[model samples]
Target: MNTSLLPTRHWLLAAFLLLATPALWSCNSQTTLQKQLSEHQDQLKQIDDDTIQSYLRRNNLLTKATKTNSGLYVVNLVDGAGAAVKTGNQVRMKYVGRFLSNGAHPASTGYPASYGDPRYPQGAIFDNSADNRTVCGCAVFTAGTGLTAGFGEGLLLSRVGDRKLLLVPSRLAYGPNGTTGIPTDAALMFDIEILEIL
Candidate 1:
């Protein structure tokens, strides 16, 4: 009720507001980032869908390739002689990964300069087996784990000795924030040859 106490109360309220400002600002900033991420994801999906459709049309693969439920497009180049790969199986394979922006050329010989691997000089090849010399090693991953959703799903659809070309959307690969060597919101194409299933 005293006039003197009014100034003290005002100062206390001002200090409280000042201290709370940063927390409020952080929440607002986080919300903004999340919204941006969601919007970016949508943009990436549209870009990927358009790119895949274009590639399919240009390559005359629209009839041969089958679209999976998750939106992956799988075109089998060779039928496997061995059993089909299943979830939880260990797979050894060779792969060449490239950005969809580089076009749909799947041949091993002529990759764009921008997409060439320094080690290969001609083109990049990713392998996970120890015996292969042309590539470091064959790609080995447990089906349904330790790999991108697209790649894993693609593997499950293949069998040993099967060669497949996969069109992977960003969400199934690295999402809106891609990892090193892959750009953010970039769609990917993977040429995979299954070598073995352990």
Candidate 2:
């Protein structure tokens, strides 16, 4: 074998060069892939919201009381006669919180059903349950204060005997970290029934 006669140097250089090219491209390629994934996720979320709004519009359902803000919408339902309420005024109610996308029960508590699993973390539920002296576990919340901005806003819009739906974005509900039943950065849906305001 006349090694000196062969273009071994050129062959080795070409192989090494080819190998180096992919390594460099891999880094850039991975970044591009991540960006595409993010874009797709965002598009899906937008489509989901658009579909929800379209359905609501087509139904022509009355919310009674409604609040829409930044990728979220809240609705309060009252009997034909509208009545208002104030927070810090003890209130009792039945409620069910669910995921808008899947309609899975996320949180529930009260009565015989009250002794069941409450899916998500609710400040009012946790706070009331801590006191055995509390009757019916009525909650005292100050509207526009002493609660998350969404909760406060929703409560303020609610009235006695009113069943309300609070739609909360991550920023107003759980933010970036998220809670037990809710996924990270997930939007929230709450169906609340106001039994009494003392």
TM-score per prediction, in order, is 0.75, 0.48
Q: What overall lDDT, based on C-alpha atoms, would model 1 receive against the true structure?
A: 0.73
Determine which window of 10 residues in candidate 1 has minimal summed lDDT.
104-113
Residue 141 of candidate 1: its Cα lDDT? 79
Error of 2 at 116 (Å): 26
Off by over 4 Å in 1: 2-5, 102-137
Q: Give the TM-score comparing model 1 with the true structure, all chains together.
A: 0.75
RMSD of each predicted structure: 6.5, 10.8
Number of the predicted model whose TM-score against the real structure is largest: 1
Model 1 alpha-carbon miss at residue 4, Å = 5.8
